[model samples]
Target chain A: MTLSPIQILVIIAAVALGTMITRFLPFFLFPDNKKRPTFVIYLGKVLPYAVIGLLVVYCLREISFSSPAGWLPEGIAILCIAILHFWRENVLLSIGVGTAVYMLLVQYVF
Target chain B: MQSDNLHSPKKPADKRIKTKALKAAFPHTIPVLTGFAFLGIAYGLLMNSKGYGVGWTLLMSLFVFAGSAQYVAITFLTSVFNPLHALLMTLIINARHLFYGIAMLDRFKNTGRLKPYLIFALCDETFSVLCAKEPPAGVEKRWFMFFVALLNHTYWVAGSVTGALLGSTLSFNTKGLDFVLTALFVVIFIDQWKQQKNHAPALIGLLCSTLALVVFGADYFVIPAMIALLAGLALYRKRAEKGETL
Candidate 1:
């Protein structure tokens, strides 16, 4: 798809406006005296987990366990990385290993 | 207050304050910068391949600045120029910012003029940094916030400009370039997971979101899953409180 100059501008403007609306609303609209409700605080604390979960699910949505090059290898890789990450607390190693395993699976095993 | 006094004896130690703030900001930001560099380059290459050049790349990064949304915007602009569709697509892609904003309200309240821009730059990575902790005393919160935004922006612009100029010169397969984002999220999840002793929330999030995705599909699951996760966590909080052996 190729956008003309005008379409590009409109898209940029819309995205910029939408981004700003979400980001700037609380800062501008909420008064300094305002106190967040209890639920808001709870939501803040739990939101990160929810976001991460969403990402994981999103990544795996296209893959299926039924296929040969499917969920078995990728799922194992994800579990391995998650375990290493949880146990050893090493981000680089987990991701590096996970990616390597994934590539291997996609290349030869799966 | 005594602890604050001991840390900042003369003139509030703003000099040391700035350095300490930078130190705190740097570690959390390394992965973000790395990921943005690759993603920005991918975006630039995609844009250039689509016939847009450096001017558009720079302008979009400066004004639009939503990484994934900007990527999707490229496709939308290329296909058709429907204003309503563009608006709706943008809203859907970026709806998570609403939650991010709510998360930041308390921390950003004292940030003064920087607050607006801080909010403007509150991408996923930025929120991870800001919501992690309070800035140390003597460090002007605005300056730290400024550096985080500035650094990420610079990396993105640099990557985009490079991609625009040398889009064809780089011959390596770019199929996996988008994985930078996935890598980044994994890094963040690991970091967040390691910090807390209680892994229940993370586990719950993983299970609930995965289940929701199976039911709702990837594009539509995020907002509803988030709401469900929040509800579940709130309900579990009482049990967590009781289980604490204080």
Candidate 2:
């Protein structure tokens, strides 16, 4: 769908405003001296991993996993990347090889 | 009290401490710059696909600068611009920043002029760098933070502009490109997992988030999953504390 110029401007304005408010809220609400409560500290520690987990699941939510042909290659590729990443701790190599393998599967194997 | 007086020579010591902190922080810029470059290019491609030209890409990257939010914002633009919807989406998408801000409160407390920009630029990557450590002594922590923010911003702007300029002239399959973000997260998870002996929190996060996704669906899952994960972790912190003590 195409956006008209006015619509685009309005959307931009709305996004900009909303983003600014979110970024600004913490600064306004908490002064420098106020220690975050223990629960918040706990949130800080666990939130990143939780967010990442949510994002990974989000990425895979739409994959058609009913058929072995459709599901197996992508599933294997994710597993390969995850295992390689865990074993070697090399992100670039893991993702690079995983993507290459996934592309080959989608194009030829599947 | 006597110790405070004995350590009255705080200024030089503080300066030394700050310098050391910044030096340690510098190495983190490498991953951030690389990730932002790829993600920024993907965002630019999405915008270009939406019929936006290089000018719009550059302007949005410069002004908006929220990486994933910019991608989502394009869809909002394509539709009728509803202020309420935009607000709700922004809150939902960027709600994680609330945690980022709380984590950063101690580090950012002493910042002066650098405070505003530090707050503005606290994306996931920036938060990763800052949350990863305490600033070393004698280094200007703010400058180090600024450097990371500035470098990542430059990578993003450069990538977006390049992608927009390239447009669709050179067509390549960008299918798995989105996994860059996932790869980043995996790397972070492994890093944190290695550091802390207790893997319960991470495992709980993984399980709760996946369960939530199954129930809520993708569009509505994030906030609920985050709430569940956070609640679960908080409930189990005593275990983690005990592990640390032991």
Query: How far off is residue A45 in model 1, in Å?
Result: 2.9
- Which regions of candidate 1 fall more than 4 Å away from where they truly are? A70-110, B1-24, B241-246
Instruction: Please give the lDDT score at residue B98 for candidate 1.
Output: 79
Per-residue lDDT tens digits for candidate 2, residues A20-110, read 7777787777777676666766665666555555555655655665688756766877877778878887756776666667667766777
Interface RMSD of the candidates, in order: 2.7, 2.6
Model 1 per-residue lDDT at B91? 77
Q: Which ten-residue region of model 2 chain A has the weakest summed lDDT?
A: A50-59
lDDT of 2 by residue, B1-246 (tens): 335422354668755654564566667777766667677777777778778988788877877777767878887877775867976897787776776776677677767766888888777777776766555555666667876776677778898988877766867766666556655666666677777776776687788878877788768887888788777777687776777631
Q: Candidates' TM-scores?
A: 0.82, 0.83
Native-contact fraction for each model? 0.53, 0.45
For model 2, the DockQ equals 0.48
